[model samples]
Target: MAAEPVRIDDPADPRIAGFVSIRERDLTGREGLFIAEGTVVLRMLGQAQARANGFAAEAILLLESRLAGIAEVLAAFPPEVPVYIASQAVFDAIAGFNMHRGVLALGRKPSAQVGASLLGRLPGTSLVLAGCGLSNHDNVGSIFRNAAAFGADAVFLDETSCDPLYRKAIRVSVGSVLTVPFSRAMAGEAMLRGLAEAGFEIWGLSPRGQVSVAAIPPARRIALVLGTEGEGLPEHILASFRTARIPQRPGLDSLNVATASGIALYQIALAMGRVA
Candidate 1:
């Protein structure tokens, strides 16, 4: 079992600095660290840590009242990971709000994997998602959640996509961001090139797509590319790759990127027999 929880009555404690003013410091504080909030996300972090899947908990700050209910999830962490408890008042003070979920973890992101390296790791018969210029956190998170639901083997985000590790994204994903393997930081064109070179049959999603996503021709590997919500996929990308549409009703320009991703992933996954 993990060690007993340490109590931190003071909100200013340096040991818990990573948890302070969390919302305001999201992009700045804790260099490469992220806050995993709620019981579900924390449990995923614990599983990753236990499996040595590249992410680990640095410390967890819990509301004192939540201890009994959360004990089993906390036990999944190794003993070396510290667990701290604070009264509701102190927890609220440190978090800069009332953290009703009452569980938070300071997690370290894995070492960066090069985009090409991530692509190379996919299985020969893989189904993956490739995102370009997807700047919305909720969209990215929902995409990841959809990926996990549909049995996508991995996800790749281009340079302009927002970090999926962002607090809101991770939470919105219901922690699927932790479970799904992903890579980011490549230029949009380079990312597509890498996928193509890796033997993936690339299909970009668009309202004007010539083929329906479900009717996509069989391929050993598939990469479904999604773009940011409003502009949809770039014109050049559409022209360069085989593009597919969801067959939406006319006059409706398009679906939300996240929602579009789910429909596309589900249809593709069904075709590939990746999902029942």
Candidate 2:
């Protein structure tokens, strides 16, 4: 069983400091720490911790009323991980918002090398998502949700891509950001080059791609590169790699980058026999 939830009536309790003003700290530049809200995400964090995926819950703050419902999830964390409970007013005060979900957690990211090491260890036959200049957290989160849905082996974000661990991004992903193995912080060109060198058949996604996504032949390792919205893929990137387009109606310019990623990843995953 998880340890009994510690009752904290004070919003300024130093132990719960991480839970204060959560909205302002969503960027989580605090040495790889992040806030996880809602039962679903807390559950995913538990799974990541259980699997030793290099993530762990440092503490959890919840409204006293939510204690019973989330007890199962709290049990997943080690007893040493503090679980703080507060009255609704105190919880709201600590979170700096209404906190309708009545749940919040402080989670620490894995080691820095976790993402960088994914490439060298992927199996010979695999499919991965390569993102370039994906500046939107919602899109990044959606891409991860899709990556997990389609069984993409991993996700690689170029230096310009937003951190998938950002608060809104993680929430938008419904915790898929924790579930999916991903690496970020490298130049666009170099990220793709590393994939190419790793034997991946890099395919860029664009509204004006050279071929239909279905036409792209199957390969042992495929890297589907998605770009930012509005501008789409960089000119240099489109020029350098094979590209695929999702056929669409005449009026619309293109699907949202996140939506497009789902369709493209589904096609590639299906072609690779990863999805039925």
Q: lDDT by residue for model 1 over 68-109, one digit each (tens)?
A: 998999999988888999999999999998899999999998
TM-scores of the candidates in the order shown = 0.97, 0.97
Tell me, by lDDT, which candidate is best: 2
Mind giving the per-residue lDDT tens digits that candidate 2 earns over 188-238? 999999999999999999999999998878999999999999999999999
Worst 10 residues of 1 by lDDT: 113-122
Model 2 alpha-carbon drift over 4 Å, by segment: none
**TM-score of model 1 relative to the true fold?**
0.97
Off by over 4 Å in 1: 114-116
Q: Which pairs clash in model 2?
A: none
